[model samples]
Target chain A: MFTAFRDHIEKNFPQLLSKPGIVACSGGVDSVVLAHLCTQTGMQISLAHCNFRLRGSDSEEDELFVKKLAEQLDIPQFITHFDTNEYAAAHKLSIQMAARELRYQWFAELMDKEELSWVLTAHHLDDSLETFLINLSRGTGIEGLSGIPPDSNGIIRPLLAFSRAEILQYAREQGIKWREDSSNEETKYLRNKIRHELVPVLKELHPTFLENFRKTQVFLSESAQILSDYTAQLKENLFVPYHQGYKISISSLQELDPLRGYLYELFKEYGFHSWNVMEALLTAMSGKEIHSKTHRLI
Target chain B: MFTAFRDHIEKNFPQLLSKPGIVACSGGVDSVVLAHLCTQTGMQISLAHCNFRLRGSDSEEDELFVKKLAEQLDIPQFITHFDTNEYAAAHKLSIQMAARELRYQWFAELMDKEELSWVLTAHHLDDSLETFLINLSRGTGIEGLSGIPPDSNGIIRPLLAFSRAEILQYAREQGIKWREDSSNEETKYLRNKIRHELVPVLKELHPTFLENFRKTQVFLSESAQILSDYTAQLKENLFVPYHQGYKISISSLQELDPLRGYLYELFKEYGFHSWNVMEALLTAMSGKEIHSKTHRLI
Candidate 1:
């Protein structure tokens, strides 16, 4: 597994090891494995852990576990305690969303301050599948259905290549001791519920659900790209940039084959998410005073 | 209304008036109004109606109604009767889908034989809005949610600028008599349900829900265009086209800011939809085979 990990890094992200970076270590099995891989590769790595203080002693213990591991590896460790509950309340965000924003924002800040090249996380394939389902259930377009990215901004997921099972297997083989958060088993989080229940049921219905879904993602991504390319060409023909958004020539738009996907692509630029809105805009192209708080297309 | 219709055509599709066209007159108020509008403008027009024969005698009545109206207007009329049930069974299509395909296919044939430039329909703003909601409910992506286009292929919707209520008002003002399809009132069909129930309920929730939805479509269309444009530029930078799909240079992609919407847009070109799949892909870039039946991106 380690050899596979080494080969993967060398092949896919050869420049990654040359940069100083921070691993978002939670002392969980996945992160521990990731940290171990980084250490084994002799990469310049710093461990960063967020102590959300959600589970009192358990949260602190997790922080301590990561700190101790970093000490044993003789790598510097950075830990931050967050008042997540208060943050969630103040921001009116779900705990998960708030925590995510807080953690990533803090990680980004640390990266900037320390001049770290990237931030690595341990998000894996199963997590990607779960997110795909969640977004699907919530009524997403092709982009939303695509799932999590490999690298966003300066954040990289080195362990994203592995499944939870694979990570656990590797951890066991390496005799790597890690902490498990009981919250993972709690169904209160939509992701956990999806991981524990929905996915298994879906897998039973179609044994290759995950594989097929991942495949579909790849296909849709490609299809989207083709459509995107077409839209780019259309934009050159149809649009002129405006102050807030864009000014589309209604006559030019009318001239284009309606089935050409460019019209829908045009709608997404203004933060509209539904087909009805597009219809309204098409209708309004004639004459109507359609207004929204933030934007108005007509 | 007739003047507005003519003005729209003259402005948007001046070439359309130079050629003969067929109006898909359904004998419903909207289509009746459209037919009258065309005749009033003294444009070369042929009236066409499809009798799906689903409503037995009522279906025949509609055909007769359209024939008499066309005769009254002293215009060429084309009428066809379809055994929709048989067609549905043979083609493995739902009755509604079968009827749509049959009607369009017949229209295309009529256009070709008659040397018609386009097939005109009476799809209005209300219909467009209903389509938008239906797609939204189905969790459609940006493209699907963009609603009905004013012109598709050789089909043009001239009355899309008007609402159903406006169409009825215009018909009444013009003293136009038309047959009503009872199926439209039936809640069994998803479109009817949306038209009668869902839209009203949504309107109640937000007085401008319909308007806002329409605006959202416009916004999303534009946003989708921008993202797609960026994706196209990024694709050229990171991928080389292959026969099957495209080969992505992992290093070039990794060098890009992943949070830039273009990353997801680039992945979407390949067919990934869920955020998780993108995350998984990012992880896979670190060296795991993200496999599907037809393709694998490692």
Candidate 2:
């Protein structure tokens, strides 16, 4: 299984194996397994842990856990604390958004200081499936179905090929200790509802559901790429820069078979998502126009 | 509600409103409500019921129910009996497939002989949601995510704008009678499982789940259309006629960012679905080939 993981990384992302990088380990089973795998594969890797301090002592415990694991493995570790609630209130962002912004911003600085080639996060198959479901439940387009990408710039997901069950099994076998985030059961969170309720039932319905989900993710991602190319050509043919934004030819758009979707895609980059209002604009009076803060469709 | 139904047809499906068409009634609340709405709108619609005789006396009762309803409305009616089991065995198809083939074949003939311009079916929002779930559970691509199309050829679905709950409420208000199909409870089937088990929980999670699903479906369908146009252009650029089959340049294919999906979409017309083996062929020995019964890729 480890060899297969190595082979997948080598084939799809060879650069990660050839150089030193930072492993964003939270001392969870997923990240711990990823770090262990990287060490076993003879990759020069160090651990980075983020303590948002949102979970009180639990946050401090997680930071300490990753520190001990790194020390035990004879590897270097870096830790950071984030004032999540303060940042969220100051920036008018959600707690999740604040934490994500602070964490990634810190990871960037760590990369430059450590001279690491990339950052590896333990985003596994389950995480990807949950993200796919979250987007689906929230009404996403072609691009949303792609799930979590395996490689994005210098950030890579090494454990993406493995499932949560596989990671738990591996951790138990290796006697790995980690902190469990109790917030995982909070149904108020959209991701938790999908992960705890929707995904399990879907998996129980079939023996190979996860494998099939992965394949479907791959298909949607590919279809999205093909659509991007097509939509780019359409934008070029039908849209032009105007006063403060752009003008889209209504006549050309009306000629489309499914005009709503084409119009949606054309104006999507400009922040228009409501299909009903956009659809009505197509047949509105000649002078009718729809406007978002960023762009306008006439 | 009936006025809204009429308005929907007038706005989006004006052809159906202007001419006569066959209403494919199943003697259910859905079709009964649809027929009543058509009459209220002052359109010419005749009910055509397909009695597959799979449900013995129950099937005959449904046929009688539809005939009586047509008589009550003072409209013409058509009924046909099909030997579904024999058809399935003879054609090496499932009973459902056999019934579908038999029903559609008869519909075409009915249309031409009766001089009807189109066929209308009461496939409501709930049915569309179930189909979406069925496709998702079975691991579908963008095309599958599109759900049921609103109009295909001369077939129009006016009732699609309404959900089953709305239709049921309408039926109660109008005191409309309908035959209940007992086979609906047989959860042994996949579609039934999705409708009964999955859809309810999803709806319960949010007040607007179905609405969101519709938006997602429309976006995906549009995306699928754009992708088809793009792939057609790509095939023109990257493929050439060679010997017994077409030749695709492996190098050009390799240049694609998401190669696995592009390759799947390329070979999909040839009935190739597996990507693992097909992906390996990209870097396999130059002479290596992946062959289906109808097509080959070298």
Candidate 3:
């Protein structure tokens, strides 16, 4: 496990070994193991903890455990508190979304103050699987099924290559003590239901579901990159800038098979979701227009 | 329902209206509704039934239902029987796989004999969803998630756009009587478990799950098509025919962003599934070769 972790960092994230980063510790086994692996691999990282205060004393204990670990390792520790429910109410967001916003916001501030290169999170293969299932059920394009990327923006997740079982095994072998989040056991949430029920059944159906899922994600991500490149090239060929707006060649667009799909790919970022309206634009009046929330096509 | 069915045919399968075709009827609500729609649309389609005999008397009843439906529609009917269990054992395939193989093989022969333009099947959106889930669980690439194609070889699935609920409603509205295959309700099989257990939960997760799923499939299929085109272009550039084999340029292959992924896309058809050895081949000694079941890379 150590060798694989070391090799992974060396291959994918060698910069972490020289530059300092912030590790977001949830006091769960996933994050704790991540921090441990970072240290073992000679990567410079500090522990950062968020006390959302949703789990009362369990939240406090989680913060305390993370602080003690930082002290034991003699590294920097950053802690933040949030009244998550109040924030959720104020923002009209779910508790999970509120916590996520608060956590990332704080991580940004910490990174700015501490001069950290990246913020490392402990999202594992199982988390990606849960996310894949959630997005699939909710209905998503290739981007949604591509799994959680190892590197996104200023955040990096090195543990994504490993499964939850592997993380648990590593923690056990290394005698790592971590606080368990009680909420994870509650199957009321959709993600929990997927993790607890759907994932186990998927695993039972295949001996290497997680491993195969990881491979599938690689294909999806690469395919997504290729498509994005193709779409960009197509956009370059079709869209000609004219007086602060680009005139798209309808004839060129019509040449593509499944024109609606191509239109969706090219203009989806502009917030247009109505395939009917976008498709109809091809045959509509010369001056007829379509408006998305962010952009307009005339 | 009739108008939508007619519009669907006119837009996508207009050739079916002008030419004669064979409808593979399973004596279920889906196929019965499809056969009715074809007749109503003035499409010349004859019903073809395959009694796999796996369900004993139920198979006989299904065949009888299909035969009556054909008689009522005033179209020619073709029927075939196979001892599916014995075939499965001999072929070392599951009963479902064996039945599928027999059905398609018989359909091909029938098409050849009857001078049919296409073999139509009643594989609706739900069946595609089931197949997608199965492929996803078993680990597959983008092609797996793209869902079942509306047209494959001479077999065409016109009902891919409609949901099972819509098909059922159509059948009821048209007073189209069909047999209920008792085996569909048995959760012992993986496909049944997915259909009965997984699909309902998925639908409950979102109000327009199936509708959105259809849209997602469109995006996936387009993405798959784009990637396939890109792969073909890459293959043309990198592979030069030399004597009896293609001389693949290693430098061009290595220039790909994710070499292993590109390698998999390019050589996967050659039956090479060992990605590790394939990647290692890049840096291995010159003239060292890797052999797949059907092809060799030197």
Candidate 4:
């Protein structure tokens, strides 16, 4: 498992190993395994811990646990505290949202100041599936189905390929002790509900659900990237820039089999959501124009 | 609900109303509602029924119910019985697959014989979700995530925008008599298991799950279409014909942000399944060539 983890990183993210990066550890099995693997691979790495102060002493223990692990591994460590509830209230956000904002903002600053090349988060396959189900229930697009990306901006998830069970098994075999956040067990939160209630049933129904999702995720991600690159090229090849926005040839577009999709690819950025309105434009009399917030397609 | 159904068809599939079409009815509430609505809209329509004979007397009752309904509505009806088990054994296919093949093949012949423009089925929103879950359990790409398509290959699903509950409620209000397939209630089938055991839980957790999936499906379908178009265009622009197959410039490909997607788009038809092996080819020594049964990319 460790070899697979290391090999995946080397194959997919070789540049990551060349840089001095920080691992965001919550003293959980996922993060501990990631830290251990990075050290075992002899990568230049450090530790970053954020005490959101949401779980009373549990938050402090998480920070302390990470600190000791970092010291034992002879890696540099950084720790910070935040009044999470206050931050959430002041920002008019959920506690989870506030923590995400606070830690990511802090991590960005630390990455720059401490000369760290990348910030690593321990988001595993199970977390990816949970996020997928969460996005499914909530309104989302194709990109949302892509789930938690492996690398985005300056942040990376080296453990994203591993499942929670794999991390737990590795920790047990390696005799690694880590703190568990009690709040994770509470099912009041949607993510927790998914992790605890929904995921197990899916796993039971299809034993290879996670591996299959991994395969689907790869296909989805590649297809999505191709769509992105295609759209970039389409802007140059298809659309002719006009006064305010662009004028797509009505006759040319109508020739496209899926008129709705063509209209969406062309006009979605202009903020038109309804296919009904756009479909009408295709057959509407010439000189008719669609007025959107940012642009127009006639 | 009927108004929305009529409006959705008028906006999306005006071609169906332009000519006479046949509805494939199982005498279920879903198809009964659809048949009522299509005639209600004054469309040129007929009824086609297939009795797979899987449920003995129940199958005969279903045929009788549909025949009576057609007679009452003053519409032409077509009904046939199939030796499904024999067909399944001969074709070396599951009973369901054999039924699907027999029906669709028959539908095609009927369409041609009757000069029908389209074939309608009563697949609805819940069915689409069940299919999405089923496809997720099985490995699939972005197109699989797109869910049950509203229209495909001359087959139109007029009730696709409505849910089963809506169909039942509409049937009750309209005094529509329909037969329920006993096989649908059997949870041994993967689809039934999903419909019975999973959907209700999802609905409880998120009331808008169906609507949200509808929205996501549109985006995925559009994005998937765009990717296909883009990749087709890429092949013409990027790759050069070399030897028996093709040659992609290594320097140009390496400059691409993601080499895997580009290579997949380039070489997928050649039948290379492993992206990792193909990706290694970009940096591999000049003599190394990737092989598939039909073609090679060096």
Candidate 5:
């Protein structure tokens, strides 16, 4: 595990090892394992902890555990508390969404303030699989099924190639202690249900389910990148700038096979999603229009 | 259901209506519903049934049911029987695989003999979802996750756009009678287990689960097509014909982002799946060769 971690960092994230970064630690096994690995690999990293106060004393204990670990490892530590429930109510967001938004926002701010080049998270392959399932359950495009990326913006997920089982095994082997988040056991959340129920069944069906999923995700992400590149070229040829907006040649668009799919991808960023209406606009009488919340096509 | 089926046919399979085709019937509700829809849509069609003889009298009953349905619909009928167990033992295949092989091979022969332009199947949205889960559980790339193709070769799945629920409702509404495949309820098969257990949970997660799956599949298939097109262009530039085989430019291949993925896709048809070894070949000694079962890359 240690060798793999070092090789992974060296191969894919050499910049991470050369510069200072922060590990977003929850004091959970995954983050704890990540922190251990990062330090062992000689990466300059600090611990960052969030106390949403949802679990009361458990939250404080988690914060304390992180602080103690930072002290033991002789690393800098940062901690913050959020009025999560109040924020969720005020922003009309679910508690999970509120926490995520607050967490990432703080991570970005901390990275800038602390002169950190990377903000590493402990999202492993299982988390990616869970997110993949979540997106798949609700129906999503290739990007949604592509799983959590290893690197996006300045944020990095170095543990993404490892599975949850591998992380747990690593923690146990190293005699590492971590706080168990009680909420994780609650199946009321769809993710928890999938993690606890769905994933086990899938794992049982194949010994290399997670590994296969990881490879599949790589293929999908690459395919998505290829499509993005192709669309960028297509946009260059099709979207000629007009007075205020771009004039697209409908005939050229029609010439593309799976026109509706290409149309969706090309116009999706413009807020157009009613695919049927968008498709209809192609063959509708001239001057026919379709409007999204932010954009219109005529 | 009827309107959706009609629209799907008119939009995707209009050619089937203009020419004669055969519907692969198992005396199941899905196929029965498809047969009714194709006939109602004014498609000249016949019923083709394969009795693998695995279900004793039930298999005979299914064949009889399909025969009676063809008579009722006033269409030509073709029936064939296979010693599925014997075939499985002889071919060293699972019973299910043996049955599938026999069924498709017979369908192809029947199509050739009867001069049918198309061979239609009753594969629906749920079946696609089940197949997706099955492939995912076993680990697969985009093509596996793209769900079943609606049209492959001369085979047309006109019912692919509809769900199993929709098919059942249509059959009930039309007062159509069909034989029950007791084997479908057995959880021993991976597909059946996923269909019975995982699908219900996924459906519970979203009201439009099947619709979302269908839409996602469209995006994936389109993305796969785009990648395939891009790779075809890459091959044209990089794979120079030399004597007996093509000599690929290693540096040109290396120039691809996600180089291993591109390598995998480009050489997968040549049977190279050890991506790491293939990547190594790029920098290996000039004459070093990587051998697949059939092909060798030097």
Candidate 6:
């Protein structure tokens, strides 16, 4: 597990260890393992935990466990408690969204306070796969199908290279102890349904479904890059920049292969679902002032 | 009806007089009416029809009816008959897809043969609405939510300015004779399902659903254009064009806002699903070399 963690950091994030960072250690199996690996790798790290106060005693206990673990590892620990349910109600957000917002906000705060260069998390490959499936079920375009990123801004996931099974094996092999969140087992949440039900069925259909899906994402990512380049060229030829928006000469645009994939991408940039909008706009050209809900392209 | 059709042409197809075109006329109310309007307006036009041969005598009757209609109007007529089921079987395409392919192919051919500039169809507002709902049910993104085009390549829909109700009303007022295709009543096809079942339910829920949806498409189209422009600028700064594909500087990309919509559009151009792939990619960057099923991004 330690070797995999170290290798993942080296391979995915070559400069990860060069910067000071805060580890979002929740004392859960995934994060605890990450904390242990960071220490073992001799990286400068601080631990931060957010007690969402969802499970009352369980939440507090989880925070205390992380605090003790931090002491044992000789790392500075920052902890916070929040009325997550109240936040959810006030913001008209789902509990899950509320918790995510709070966690990220708190992590950002901790990073600033400690002057950390990066905020590290322990989202593994399995989590990425789960997210891919969830998004797929929700009627996404190709972009939605691409799955999660390994890094963004100063936020990073150093353990995403390993699967949950691999992480668990590593934790056991290294004699690492961690807490389990009971909520993870509940099927009420969409993610939990995906994790516990949908994925298992999908796995039965294709043993390597998760791995294959991830692979598909990589190909899609590469393809997206090429199409974007083409769109850039097309834009240079057809679009004139304006202060508020742009002026796309209908005649110039008419010269393009209407089926060119990049054209769709270009359309998407203007907040249009390029394909349908282009089709509609192109079709509208034969009619008088075609109006849509918000705008008219005459 | 003729006045509305001429007005539509004047407003939408400002350059229609410069182009000679073929009207895709079946002896149907919509196309027959459209053909009559074009003739009355003295727009150079020829009649084109596809006989899918699905209705035995009825199919032949429709063809004979169109031929007589063209003759009566003193317009040159083009006709093609096809064993649609056989074509579907040979091409391994659904009957609807096969029929569509055949129709468009024949229309294009007639356009070339007659030296016509454009191939005109009778698709109108109601057809556009049905397409939007169908795409939406199939889980389309913004692009899919937009309805059909009025002009694609050299193909144009001069009647798209009016709704189906308007077309029927116009036909009644003009005393136009038309043959109704029995297949339209068959709900086995997805398009038919949308027209017969889904549309009524939707109309009940929102009386102006079709109009509203069309409006939404126009808004999205404008938005898509703006986003494409922004992405082009961003791409100029970050992408290094290579012999085969381009390379994105990780550092430059990292500096952008996480919600940079244009970046997603740019990625989509490369055949990638912009947002999800970027998210997964960014997430993967924090870890060691994560191998998805097919490709590995370090």
The whole-model lDDT of each prediction reads 0.73, 0.81, 0.85, 0.81, 0.86, 0.71
Q: Give the TM-score of candidate 1.
A: 0.52
User: Interface RMSD for every prediction, one decimal?
Assistant: 9.2, 1.8, 1.7, 1.8, 1.4, 10.4
Off by over 4 Å in 6: A205-209, A228-239, A250-264, A267-298, B1-298
Per-residue alpha-carbon lDDT of model 1 for A202-298, expressed as tens digits? 4543445455555544444554555556566767767788886677766676554332344556556655533545565578647764455566667
Please give the lDDT score at residue A156 for candidate 2. Answer: 92
Give the alpha carbon lDDT tens digit for every residue of B1-298 in model 2. 8878888988988887678989999998889899999998888999999999888898989999999999999999999999999999999998889988998899999999989999998898889877776666778888887878888877788877788888999999988888887667652376666666667767765678777777777778777877776778889998897887667666787887677777777667887765743654654676667667776556
Q: Compare candidates 2 and 5 on DockQ and give the better one.
A: 5
Task: Give the worst 10-residue stretch by lDDT in candidate 6 chain B.
Answer: B288-297
Please state the CAPRI-style docking class of candidate 2.
medium
DockQ of 3: 0.53
* Tens-digit lDDT string for candidate 1 (B1-298): 7778889889876767888899898899988888898888878898999999898788889999999999999999999989999999999999989999999999988888878899898888778777764554443455554567667898998777667877898889878898887777662466766665545544543445455555444444544555556566667767788877777765565554333234556665556544644565578647766654455675
Worst 10 residues of 3 chain B by lDDT: B274-283
Write candidate 5's Cα lDDT for B1-298 as tens digits. 8888889888877898788989999999999988998888888999999999988899999999999999999999999999999999999999989999998899899888888898999998888998898888777888999999999998888788888888898888889999888787662577766877778878877788788889899888987776777678778888999999997766677677666677877877778884744655654766767778898877
Most accurate candidate by lDDT: 5
Q: Write the per-residue lDDT of candidate 2 for residues A1-298, one digit (tens) a residue.
A: 5787789887878898788889999877789888888888778899999998887787888888999989987888999988999999999999889988998898899999989889999999999988877676677777887889877778898677788988888788888777787556652466776766677777766678888777777788778777776778888887787777556665677787676767767667768865644654654686566667765555
By DockQ, who's the top model here? 5
lDDT ranking, high to low: 5, 3, 4, 2, 1, 6
Every model's DockQ? 0.04, 0.53, 0.53, 0.50, 0.63, 0.03
Candidate 4 lDDT score at position B257:
55
Candidates 5 and 6, the one with greater TM-score = 5
CA lDDT of B185 in candidate 2? 67
Model 6 gets an lDDT of 0.71
Candidate 1 chain A TM-score vs. reference chain A: 0.86
Off by over 4 Å in 2: A186-188, A236-257, A272-298, B236-257, B266-298
Tell me which of candidates 1 and 4 scores higher on DockQ: 4
Per-residue lDDT for A1-298 in model 5, tens only? 9999999999989999789999999998999999999999899999999999998788889999999999988999999999999999999999989999999999999999989998999999999999998899888888999999999998999899999888999999999988887778762488877877788878866788888899888878877777777778779989999999998776777787666677767877888874844655654676667778888777
TM-score of chain B of each: 0.77, 0.88, 0.93, 0.84, 0.93, 0.80
Docking verdict class for candidate 3: medium
